[model samples]
Target: MIETSTSICEVIAKLRIAREAPYYGREYAFGELWNALDRLDDREADDESR
Candidate 1:
């Protein structure tokens, strides 16, 4: 799993770039990736609530 916010952002950035390529996840099969991104957003929200 993504360990740090920097790492998470890096991976999401790469994944999004890859996603734009043709024939990549045509049906968007990797739900965990999406979940991780959501988790990152949730984490940010939690941090901001402090």
Candidate 2:
């Protein structure tokens, strides 16, 4: 759980950094971050359903 929390925090930080950037990579980074969060949400939902 600690590791997962840490990873989520890291992804959030990356999202913030990407949002601040003024380049083309920002969109890609945001997409990746969104996907990561989506996966995490799916996992949590599955866990809850179980």
Candidate 3:
């Protein structure tokens, strides 16, 4: 699980770089990643509240 999470973070970092460069084609994937991360944050907050 730790390894998987680490890999996911690495992928996100690369997507962020790609998004910034603007020469790497469409930025759709980066936007999706941001939305997914926001959902993850919300879930974590809910779990903590419980």
Error of 3 at 18 (Å): 7.7
C-alpha TM-scores of all predictions? 0.47, 0.65, 0.51
Clashes (N, CA, C under 3 Å) per candidate? 0, 0, 0
The models' CA-based lDDT, in order, is: 0.63, 0.77, 0.64
Global CA lDDT computed for model 2: 0.77
Give the range of the ten consecutive residues with the poorest summed lDDT in model 3. 1-10
Better of 1 and 3 by TM-score: 3
Instruction: Encode model 1's per-residue lDDT on 1-50: one tens digit a residue.
Output: 33456758755775775567556653463454566677777777777787
Query: Lowest summed-lDDT stretch of 10 residues in model 2?
Result: 1-10
Q: Write the per-residue lDDT of candidate 3 for residues 5-40, one digit (tens) a residue.
A: 665686687677657765555476676667667756
C-alpha lDDT of residue 19 in model 1: 69
